[model samples]
Target: MLTIRPATSADAQVAYDIRREAVRHHCIGAYPAEQMLAWTAGTAEDGYASLMASHFYMGCIEGEPVATGMLDVNAREIGAIFVLPGYMQQGLGKQMLAFLEALARNLGLAQVNLDATLNAAAFYRQCGYVGEATALYHSPRGIDLACVPMTKVLV
Candidate 1:
């Protein structure tokens, strides 16, 4: 069984590892190698530590953290929902998304939005997010990646 819990600075490496695996393995079909590499290069342990400290970032753990999700209440956005490549297609992503949405509802958010990578936009759509437009997102190193802006209203 998978359990969701608050992530800490200590889990930074786990989060970083999962994001790297997911981006490297699953996103190749949608993005070129250079862009993918740039996106993956954007985060590190310190980045995740600040994310955990500022937002509602959670981990999905069985024996270890195999998935992570971030919900920024101030932005009302769902950020960086990722599952380890080996753990894909196991419904972990859906569960984390539901948890984020529920948190948004409880926080009095009327809607939640995300900048979904081209590779992940379909998955977000499957979870009820409507794609608004395709846009360019800049990486930390200033590489532009194609992304879809998506939103889902809380009912």
Candidate 2:
């Protein structure tokens, strides 16, 4: 069984590691290896710490940090939803999504938004997030990635 709980700064490295695995192993088919590796390597402590401190970032796991995601509670923005390759089909991502959605509801957020990776567009759609737009994400280092901007308005 997987459990969802608040993530701490100490989990920064683990979250980064999970994000790296998700981008490489699961997203390699959609993005070039070089671009993916560079993107993953560029993310580290500073960003994750700030996110844990302010947002509703939660880690889901059976034993360890198998997945992590965050909700920008005020804006109801969901970010960095990742499930390690081996843990993908086991429903851990769903568990993490549930936590973020519940947090959004509890916070009285009227809507939630996310930029979904190519492979994850369908999943987000299934979760009731309509595709509001498509974007060419130009990384700070100039790597271009395709993303679908999605939104779900809550009652």
The numbered model that scores best in lDDT is: 1
Per-residue lDDT for 152 in model 2? 88
lDDT of 2 by residue, 54-152 (tens): 563545555577888888766668888998898888877777887788888888888898889988898888888899577986655566788998998
Q: Pick the candidate with the highest TM-score.
A: 1
At residue 54, what lDDT does model 1 achieve?
A: 58
Q: What would the per-residue lDDT of candidate 1 be over residues 27-84, giving only the tens digit for each residue?
A: 8889988777767775565355567665546555555888889888888998878888
Q: Each candidate's root-mean-square deviation in Å?
A: 1.7, 2.1
Residue 121 lDDT, candidate 2, scale 0-100: 92
Give the Cα error of residue 55 in candidate 1, in Å.
2.9
TM-score of 1: 0.91
